[model samples]
Target: MTQVALTISAEADLIRVRQVLRARCQRVGLGLVDETKLITAGSELARNILTHAVGSRGGVRVEDVARSGRQGVKATFFDEGPGIPDVDQALVDGFSTSGSQGIGLPGSKRLVDEMTITTEVGSGTVVEIVKWRRDRSWRP
Candidate 1:
């Protein structure tokens, strides 16, 4: 697996995240659908990082994984925020403590092949998502 990691801060980083993901998708020859999904998912996670993290910054890491003649991208977000008090409730559709769009987490998960999150009550959060290339034989 190959990994790309970065610290996320300011609104500009939001756009940067999408750009980086799109570039990686292109580098790995991912299709438009896959690229779009990565962009959307990246945006959502970045939004959450900005909104909830407050004074702290977050990190986003993207990795390339190969298996079974297929390639997948894994994106992970780490934040030093107040963290989710209730993971189950936060993941449920239409349930948001911040009360914004409430679609960031759930929507992001729907766009990826796998999604996992972990958080501490007073520490921070880590969200990881993976998207597999559409073509099984695809490679960079």
Candidate 2:
């Protein structure tokens, strides 16, 4: 089940995107902590898109995925910016090409159950993040 899909052109639109994601996650019975993590991860990725790919547009997609007969929330952020040249270095903590705190990739990886990055120089970047439903708890 896909819940939220949004595109942001302005940096200010990123906040609204995050809010929509958080609300959609909560409505689906994802834990509060999980919702926060999703929003934070989305914010970081969206911010990167805005700062690096300004004047371009990007979006976040929220989906419900089934695994081992269970379901979970899956979120993806995509941008059509100058793709990362070095994916290995890009994943390292504090290794930003930009003069900013470099926790976007690694930090987002830690927040989600799984993450995957795909990019091509002069093309774009796509980051997919997933958080599986934990059987130990059910919000609904």
Structural RMSD, model 1 = 1.4
Runs in model 1 deviating more than 4 A are none
Q: Which is the leading candidate under TM-score?
A: 1
RMSD after CA superposition, every candidate: 1.4, 1.8
The sequence of per-residue lDDT tens digits that candidate 1 reaches over residues 6-87 is 7788888888888878877887778899889988998899889999998997989987767778787778999999999988
- Provide the overall lDDT of each model, using Cα atoms, as 2-decimal numbers: 0.85, 0.80
lDDT (Cα, tens digit) per residue for candidate 2, span 49-95? 88777666677787777677655777788888898899999989999
Q: Which pairs, if any, clash in model 2?
A: none
Error of 1 at 28 (Å): 1.7
Query: How close is every model to the real structure, measured as TM-score?
Result: 0.93, 0.89
Q: Where does candidate 2 stray beyond 4 Å?
A: 1-3, 136-140
Report how far residue 54 has shifted in candidate 2, in Å: 2.1
Residue 51's C-alpha lDDT in candidate 2? 77
Worst 10 residues of 2 by lDDT: 131-140
What C-alpha lDDT, on a 0 to 100 scale, does residue 20 get in candidate 2?
76
